[model samples]
Target chain A: IPVLALGIGSPTWAVEAAHERGSLIVSLVGAPAHAESAIRAGADLLVAQGTDAGGHTGPIGTFSLVPQVVDVAAGRPVLAAGGVATGRHLAAALALGAEGVWMGTAFLASVDARPSGSVLDKLLAAGPGDTVVSRSDSGKTLRMLRSAWSDEWEAPEAPTPLSMPYQDILIGDLLGQILRHEVAPLVHEAAGQGVAHLTAQEPVAEIMGRLVREADQVLADLGTTRSASPASIRPAT
Target chain B: IPVLALGIGSPTWAVEAAHERGSLIVSLVGAPAHAESAIRAGADLLVAQGTDAGGHTGPIGTFSLVPQVVDVAAGRPVLAAGGVATGRHLAAALALGAEGVWMGTAFLASVDARPSGSVLDKLLAAGPGDTVVSRSDSGKTLRMLRSAWSDEWEAPEAPTPLSMPYQDILIGDLLGQILRHEVAPLVHEAAGQGVAHLTAQEPVAEIMGRLVREADQVLADLGTTRSASPASIRPAT
Candidate 1:
């Protein structure tokens, strides 16, 4: 096994069981207290998810969450996630004290991603502001495309969305119909704000190569302190 | 002036005028398109302000926003802001293609901060989840502490807060009274999610020294790729 890990927001009975079973537990934390608790619960790793992330995310941003989790983790590895799409994000994550990065948005633009039909077209063209976190489904925050359906659901006159299974069931048929008809404006997509960087639909290998090269360049730049000082800011003779 | 730059979100009438005076205008943008416009509007530098910042911020996270801004900035310098409270954050910003970083929350715990009474005590103890973005005044979103006032205003049953001047006037007296009484839970404090990192009150010089030392250490670590080979991930001969 190549280091199997479980991803969870809370440490439950299963987490300790997983630890005992020799599986590494990767606890996801949004708050600093959760980071502490995750470490206390015997997690081998921590993933800090920020508000700008896709699918489900919490109140803080990745820039704020990673450092806090790394501090609480002490020496344990902490992976930075949410809004990481390009190679520069990997470099940024490492600089933030993360051992690695976890990203879901970049692959959506890759040929291998399982997003159906013309979804990649939409994802590739969308800008950074196109995603929003709303309680339109399951009465819980989810980061997805800013569709008309989401906008209507978030409108002042709309009723509060029901919780969990009931809300999922309630919205299922509408989602199906929208996708079935390819109603672009009503479609919901689990894309992070980093979707803004997707320029063309390329292979996973191409993406990986670019990411590694960019990260390497960033490291080289850091070693040299790459900015040139303006003569005005230089010490006067 | 060494470099006369304007800090603003909108393209004010004075921006072009300042450019005419041979000053390097610096505009703050959250979206990539905004970066493009700021450049077209005679800005010589761009500051990417992510949503993790206090006072005013945008929807994207710093990790995602920085590279995007840098890409669109062309030859212009780009600075990253929001949730930058440590040397690690500065390193992260630089890795994301920023020339520098802008910070606010770190100074709140410094001796120079103007917080009265035991406000600094509470700030030092608060975690990453302590701040929230609420539409309390100006009808514009502002990042601040999760106080009773914000909670009450954000509650579902609460009436829509008035806009701008009216809103400020409406909440002014209440805020003044809360400050006068030092009602800890009701006082609105502008702090970013990075408040979790604040541990003690120190001098500005001390903070700067530690930040420089930590940044140097981070750069050195990057040059070396500081990570031990895991036994589990070792290649079998």
Candidate 2:
């Protein structure tokens, strides 16, 4: 599967070239405008990413972004991303009109992924609110495990983080030293709000199995109430 | 329904008083911690409000907040709030373990709502991104239609908005004058990201009918794909 990072200005020529080779291009989008641009660039699949997503993300929440992207996708398939860690989340994404999910943080602590000890520990210890979106590490807004380093960067006296590659260059050495030396206070990893559900390190197969089992159970339970209609919707005044 | 604004200082005695009256107590919470507090305060039903909600809201998004609240609520019913305007949203809310939805933004433009002409116009003209959460209005973070007033408050030289009733007192006269004069650039209304769907003023009955019809269709469409097991869940690389 050919994929493109449309957020950082992937050339349309690259998308066209990939299309010419009969590759199905997948593009990640944080908003509907991005989805439109991806479609214009010949992307076959669109991932509607939300602020809850780890790494680089957008302002819109997944619940709000998915339906909007689906609307803009026209006939193209749209996948939901950000905060997608459970079977219930997958079911919710489907209900929001996505064909599937694009998960990232769920696998960060998986056995096969082999994340470093410090990173894995942080990922496991984080609650839903333990992550914050900051431009300190990357020039672009990124959701990651909060740490003392992030707090320092967020202080009033801290210099504004530069944009894009420039910011990466400015912090490259300090980040390397922190990681190489395993500075616990400064060490952090990119993760999503879904990290709240990740309490244990399991294999990919176990994770996949649990997601399917839980989602099936949820879907079946909701199916029994499928006849719920407008009359049944109680207004919460 | 004995609803409580637990965000503010709703005394425990009031909750006890309402409970004594044999009324079901409902409280809104934005995060799991808030839900725990509400539960402790004797709330019987919980509305898991997300940042996408209109007016005062919490930092968490509905997609991430609902299931967590459900887990905390245990057997207690949870209603999803924020960005809940469409039928698909209702279906998605149910899938996220919410028994129903608590809608606010969707009704702002309804004929029965009778919002001021200017406020209704702004709501109609706004897009999903047009609403922002700011502390400038009520001294609490509120989601409202973005306007010049909000822009002014967000200026670097602007003073921090005072908390709660103090903020209300400081801006009360100015807000009244703006509304009384129908100041086009200053007049705004609380709304959610779902304002993108409120294109025109319709009756509550019409809105309800459409919600039921669309939700039924979506639920039915998803029911066919309910058998989609883990194997069918394709990885979007």
| DockQ leader | 1
Instruction: Report the C-alpha lDDT of model 1 over A144-222, residue by residue, as the tens digit.
Output: 8888888999897898888876888998888888888888878778878888878888888898898888888888778
Write the residue-wise lDDT of candidate 2 on A56-167 in tens digits. 9877888998999999998678889999889999989988999889898999999999988898898898887898889998899998899998898899789989998899
Cα lDDT tens digits for candidate 2, B1-237: 434445543356877887677666778888888888888877778899888889998667788889999999987888999999889999889889888899888999999999889998998988768988889889999988999988999987889899988999999999999999999999988888889889999999999899978887877877778655533322222
- In order, the TM-score of chain B in each prediction is 0.87, 0.92
TM-scores, chain A, per candidate: 0.89, 0.92
Q: Best candidate, TM-score-wise? A: 2
Clashes of 1: 0
DockQ of each: 0.51, 0.46
Determine which window of 10 residues in candidate 2 chain B has minimal summed lDDT: B228-237
